[model samples]
Target chain A: MVNKFSIKNLDMYYGDFQALINVNMEILDKEITALIGPSGCGKSTFLRTLNRMNDLIEGVRVEGEILLDGENIYKDIDVTKLRTRIGMVFQKPNPFPMSVYDNVAYGPRAHGIKKKAELDEIVEKSLRRAAIWDEVKDRIKKNALSLSGGQQQRICIARALAVDPEVLLMDEPTSALDPISTLKVEDLAEELKKDITIIIVTHNMQQAARISDKTAFFLNGELIEFDETDIIFSVPKDKRTEDYITGRFG
Target chain B: MKKKINFKEGLIYGIIGVATLFTIGILVFILGFIFSKGLPHLDSHFLTSQFDSTSAYVDVKLSEGTENPLGLILGEMTLKEKGSIEKQVIVVKDIEKTSLAESAVNNKGQNLAISKNDIINRIEGENVEGKSVDEVNQILNSINADKVTLRITKQGGGIFPMLMTTLMMIGLALLFSVPIGVLAAIYLVEYAKPGRFVNLVRFATESLAGIPSIIYGLFGMILFVMTLNFGYSLLAGALTLSIILLPVIIRQTEESLKAVPDSYREASFGLGANKIYTISRVIIPTAMPGIVVAIILSIGRIVGESAALLLTAGTAAKIPSSLFESGSTLTVKAYTLAKEEANIELASAIGSVIIIIILILNALSKLLSRKITKI
Candidate 1:
């Protein structure tokens, strides 16, 4: 099976300070991969590399190959096309200043979906995939701001899904959400991995254990461990990973 | 025990306190005085028409005499000092002013007239009965018509045109300023790389704001009026006001755009939105109410401006048929009235309308700004 994305000897920088150092990872096709770490860890920075989201930040530079389906995305590939293939949801629930339906349609519209019926179907299907359709379907035309934090987060997830990306990258997607919303996203991630590859950066160890097929641990700008989820939790290869999961150190 | 505030701090605070109170006191006093002196003359004719010069010189004639025609059966007109009587007499015999040449001053300082037509004609109009234009002027020289007693009627200063002029100028000014300034701000905030050039733009905008409005006026008068050949027209005033408002729009819009979290921009980009699309669809909309507020403040500033409009927009008090037509706005009208020492009541009424317009604009801005967070 072809790996959806593979990073080889990647390093990243923000001006003089190094954020990720000599990192290598392969995200398997249609698999749920969880990146677990403490605060200031390079996990989120590493996740941003897959879709080249870090390009938006000023003073950011990345090194080495980020091959998505065998093509180095950092090379001659169109960045816009690259981003369209890999969707992202952020930590905070940032719905656009529009109706909930329009928020979902934002991505599809950007990729050029103008027919109303197509957008409507995409919005419904995507929202259902994100597990927010039943709650928001009645009032999709209302402002997305009127929704609660959890609903908004799910709406953001639905918005990302509407673009039909093959890969979904979540950078601490549940950090700003409440416990119930976090569980809901975890469950949604589980179901989504059947059709699309998902790489989630998370601080919560239990969520990593419950939803992931593979686990990668990062600390101080380095990939500390990468292994099967159960073994990594039960028998981590690195002392740092063991220490972190056991709460002896972070 | 804790010591009380030091004498120096107390003195500093006391000075600030006194200054605040002094400002409040002055505003209260001004408002009271304006409301008192100007309020009584706020009538419908004053609200509806231009100050009639004919109101200044009334003609009274007695039918029994060969001369007096407004039928001066009663002539002495008076009000509490702010009002006085203007008189002229045209003598009509066989329905023609037979003794029109006899209109002159009596020994008692009151105007004695054989005919009102001769007196009325000298002050303003033509068509005096049986008198040549020169003969009418000679009679006016000898008449006891007191120019001092000529009260320009408060009913004459119409608020409609000046009010319309102020609105149109402000509307055009906003139309010119807001789009360009706001787009510039969006570029600076979202797309531009930070460097010496951006710094220069920032400095230039700030400096432009600090440039006196009169300088803007002079530039407009010279450039748009003379060089561009627009003349002292609405377009000239609007363009001048737009320049004056540019810095304000840029600064306010920049601040408001900056207030939107970087995360939103990142999210938009992460969703594969182009820079232009993100700015136009998301950032600008989020920053819209703030831009509107900046526009409203610009409106108030432009409406209250006189010196700027005086040089750029001529004080031609007539209905402007087109953008190129010479026009006088409310501020210009108030200024001309005050300068000529013409009707204060009329001028005060114009000032009151300006205030009302500013208040309405502020309320509208407040209303418009409420949608940003919800948008």
Candidate 2:
């Protein structure tokens, strides 16, 4: 398997507070990697660092190297281009207050795709990939906010997919969803892993073990352990990881 | 179980209700008074004519030692001159024979008959011929004639020029203020860091809003009218009004921009869109309804503003041919009518018109906000 992202000695700080310490991980292409921890464990912060979404926040300082395909994302890449190559789905569904068609087409339109027919194709294909085309095809012109929460989340996924990014970062994308919607998003994520690498930060242990090929355990801004998902669940080398997975502590 | 009433809560509610009713009552009473006094006089003629009555003056000479020297009663009578042409001329309705000037010649060197119902188109040696009615009246009045009759032909009543000036002021003020104010607001809300300088700027804007509008008028008079030599023109008045409107526009626009969710910015940025694109497309469109409401309210302010315009826009009751020319808005015209001319009915009519304009603007803003939210 080819490595999609390589992080080396990464440390991140928000002013005086350190959110992520010296962490290192290699994310493989076309595989689902899950980061699991309790609340405020810096998993979400680490996920944001993949796409540099943390740059939007004030007083954030990052050090060390995060390489995408052997190119340093921080030093050698434009932030906009990097973001286009790596898309993010937030914890809550945030569809723009516009038509569903417009929400899906916003990314491509921003990137200078103007022709109606071409945009139509991209919108339909993206909605299909997000597994929401059939449900929203009839009401495509309606405002995206008018939809159910689960449907809105799916539309947001379609919006992210419209730009055709190589990597997808999901920060607790199912935390705001009900059980059925969570299952649908999980299935969609599994199906999407055949093409693009996905990095998901989830708190649910069963979810981390179920779909992810590789799992990384984090505690207090430090990476405790990283291994194959089955091995991490069955036999963890570190006592903290074993304790966290076996429900002794998080 | 029986529930007990809280005295404090009931007292607070009673106070609030009375205050609300008091406010509404004052507004209704004022509107009722203005409409009742003004609407009867607000006709098409009143809206379309000048504010002064049209008058024509004629000089008459009485022979010495004549009886009934002041008995020559004057009335407007149409007479047919050469070629069967009919024209409105001030003629003598009743004259004593002893007051006749047999050798009197008209200004045209033709023999004049001092009989009753004779046409008096000109006065001797005054050069009143071939001049406009206003000039002729002025000349006739300047002569100090002992026997002159002023004949009023038309009543001055219209507010057309004032209405136009008010509309133009609203347009020009918005033109000057909206772009600068909205841009300033965007910068403050989106780009400026929350620090000493930004806080100071916000404080300054708030202070500007609270300053009396008459002070703005004084400043505008010194800057635009005296220094710039605009000389009490519509442009000067509009510029002054623009300054008065700036703080309001900036504050409202900033509030609207701040109301836009940070999630929208995140979403747009995550899609590789630049800040300009994100703001123009996502943020501005969402905040448009609020901005529109702000503009409408600013227009209402412009319509009702009088003191600042009175100092800058001179009270010229005529249609301005250019921006440099003087003009009067509805409020300023009403002020002049009520204070200088003491024409209460016309002033009340102007006040009613201003009220109607503000009501329309309020309704329009509500409708627009609803439509935008629906979209």
Candidate 3:
């Protein structure tokens, strides 16, 4: 399998406090890679560094190389262009206070797609791909925030997909969702990895085992173990990974 | 524990009720006072007509004289002061006016066999019989072949012009201040790094807000009016008011911008939007309510502003022909009318109109904000 992202000796700091320490991982193209960890385990931090979303924080120091398609994203790539290629969905659903149609078209519009017919086609296609077209086609002009939490999250996924990104990063996207919504998102992620690379940070180990092909276990800013999901779930090399997986201590 | 909580809750509820009632009562009393005093004087004529302080109409009686009474009034008449009545004796000028006055004499059916001096003497008589003021004015109006030019002094020049000036000043002030203030706020909230200079700037903004409006008036007088040679113009007043409103707008806009969730910014950025695009598209739309509140507050301040305008935009009650000309706003006109003319009713009428305008503005902005939030 071709590698979409290659990280080497990654370290991240907020002011003087270290959040991510010497993390190395390869995320494969057209595959689902799940990062699972306990609370404050830096799994989400590692997810943010992929698209350089961490640059918004004040006094943030990063010492690492994050390469996307053989180009060092941290050094050579323009952050805005890099973000276009790597999309993100936060844990909590945050739809812009706008119409559902506008929300889906926001990304395309931002990148200078001004034609109405073009936007309409893109909105329909993206919403269809995000699996929300049937649920929302009639009320596409309605406010995005007026929808239910699950539907709004799906709309956000549609919004992110409207830009046609190469990679999608979801940071505990299902944590705020109900069980049904969580299953729907899991299924969506499973289907989406056929076309785009996805790196998800999840606390639900069973969810990680169910959807992800490869899983990386992190503990206290350290990558404890990384292997195929079945191996990590059944016979992990590290005791900590095994303990976390078996529900002894998370 | 439940009983103790009930007593505390009752106390708090009582306090809140009293506070709310006190606020409502004061508002009712002020509205009642203005309406009662102002409603009677708020006619269309009072709102539209123009008058000057220099001229007045006086009633004069004519005594019976022997022979032809030379009945003609002309320009440049000399008046002798009487008890609240000024009797003016005039010589004849302009043959057309002489003919008009002759018709008045014929209408009264009096014998006109007198000289101009005799006419003057007759007009000065104490116990003379003559037409009433209204009757004379009617006769003068009809016979003149021109029009009645009653120089009614001590009348208000209407509030319409002052209202226009007030609106214009507000528009100009908002135009000048909103952009600068919002941009400055954006810089402070979105772009500025935490440092000593940013802290100092914040402190300066706070201090500017705390400064009295009178001080702003003084500064405006010196800087805009005198040094800039604006000469108490509308532009000067708008510039001065913009400075006064700047700190408030900046602070409120900053607060509103800060109130926008970090998640929205992240979402916008994650879509490959740059800082400017994200701020314009996401952050500003969400913070629009608070920004509008700031603008409305600034408008309220501008509308009620008198002292600052009196110093910067001189108390000329006439409509300004251009932005560079001097004019009085509604509040300044109210102050001038109340103090100089001592016409409390006219001032109250102006105050009432101002209140109505502000109420409309507030309601419109609220409706607009509601629409924005709904979208």
Candidate 4:
């Protein structure tokens, strides 16, 4: 629960095509780590591997040691439990055709939280932690779809937190929203890092630099560089990282 | 000067427009004639009645104070063959017009009592001297509607029972078609490996859809009715409807499943849920509107069917007590009324009922789907 994910020699393939190769990294305990790369450069692929999500695809094969808290996840992990522990928020807000309160409580219910009072407390606390409680408190029973895009996204973040996961994975969570919504998610992510370790896959280099403590740059399924956020942006060791950050070539 | 313009294109455009209009006009004319010929029979009794096709019964009262008045023909037959005297029959004023047996007693509740002069008058009335046989026959066959009326009533059945049967049949069919169709679609979208077997399964599903309803009905009869000893039951009718609806359900559900963007599935799986859970919770709910539309179309087809139910479900106009009972549906009633008695009015009334039912069902489905698909 305290220690975070450690991935080593991770390889992923879609049939004969290689999508990620030799991905090695450690997500620090209770810290925000940013995965930065161009589109289709395997940063999102790396984020997905933490939850063993790629296994759902036909003809997908993985060879990797993805450990959560010193336990090898790929060897004997119950993926449902693994996923509930490492909760994820998606690129677009995917609230259930349900009330905002129910949307936040879904993960906990799936994990067998049946008492209404317990679920109510969890929903409230999670929404408050996501910094969206005040805006949505009066209308929790209304449909989540009626909310603004940013509020919906925050509700989804609240949904992820309602299960009390040790880690939260965000795969370009603000990519589908407007700038204002993105700013809200960025601020929420900044606050969430106080208690939970956050792994974010982002295309925006400036957002990664502004938010995360550690930053890892990837190029063509390979990790080009990994360093502290300030060093990765200001004094990176690799030329590819510098080129990608400066928008020279993808 | 006019001939210098593009006459060929103008002629082609005029011809195409004329052809399209003509085609539409022909369809409208055919429908209009059939409906107009059929629509007038719409009434409460017409809707509620059935055709016995056996006989016409009328009680002939000797009308007013002329003692022992003569029976007469109305000459009101629609079939006008000028020379035929085939339907000519002498009838006594003391009997019902439906049966050939003359009564031994009259309406005064007295026995046949004829005086010598009365017998002589009857003997003279029987002769057709100086008259054509057909003319004389017309005179003898007419009956006054005020004194006696002959209306066609069903032997032992009406259309209401059949209306209930068909509704239940369609409901069961929808129940059968929806869940399996959705699951098959989910498998195709979320689970099936791309291969020869998968392609063959998809092709089979499509082929099942194209099979005619009559063929499905026959199969249902053989499999569910005769072989299984269901004996013209609602289950058999429902089974036939389900087979007919299967292709429709699968095709629509598959299209809807495909319509849901792949990103949603990826989003769900990324949350660590399995493929099954993702499909049931996310993919299916997202594609539900199309599935509901498909179900509505299937229900329409099932409700409008006649030929299929005729063979499998039987044409007995009885209330079904159970799924095993032979029952007639509204479509079957229409067919029976229109053909057996040539009663177009009752047929139209039935048609109108069927149309209203289908419209209500489709509207209800659309409303429910809209509610669910509120986003």
Best by DockQ: 3
Angstrom error of the Cα, residue B45, model 2: value is 3.9
lDDT of each: 0.78, 0.86, 0.82, 0.74
Question: Model 2, B259-335: lDDT tens per residue?
Answer: 88888999999999999999999999999988998899899889989999999999999878899999999999999
Model 3 segments beyond 4 Å from truth? Answer: B1-27, B51-157, B361-375
Of the candidates shown, which would achieve the greatest lDDT relative to the real structure? 2
**Model 4 chain B poorest 10 in a row by lDDT:** B115-124
lDDT of 1 by residue, B174-284 (tens): 999988998899888887899988999999999999998899999999999999999999999999999999999999899889978777787788888888778877887
lDDT of 1 by residue, A1-250 (tens): 5688888999999999999999988889998999988888988888888888888778999888989889999996788888888889888888887899989998888877899999999999999999999999899999998999889988988988888889999988898988988889888999998889999998888889999999999999999999899999999878889999998866
lDDT string for model 4 (A100-178, tens) is 9877877776666789999999999999999999999999999898998889889889988887888999999998899
Name the lDDT of candidate 4. 0.74
- The fnat of each candidate, in order, is 0.61, 0.70, 0.89, 0.39
i-RMS for every candidate (Å) is: 1.6, 1.7, 1.7, 2.6
Q: Which DockQ value does candidate 3 get?
A: 0.53
**What does candidate 2's lDDT look like per residue over A34-71, in tens digits?**
99988899999999998888998899999989999999
Two-way lDDT contest, 1 vs 3, winner: 3
Error of 3 at B258 (Å): 1.4
Angstrom error of the Cα, residue B55, model 4: value is 14
Query: What is the Cα-based lDDT of residue B115 in candidate 4?
Result: 14
| Candidate 3 vs candidate 4, lDDT winner | 3
Looking at model 3 chain A, report the run of 10 residues with the lowest lDDT sum. A241-250
Residue B126 of model 1: what lDDT? Answer: 39
- The C-alpha TM-scores of every prediction are 0.82, 0.81, 0.82, 0.78
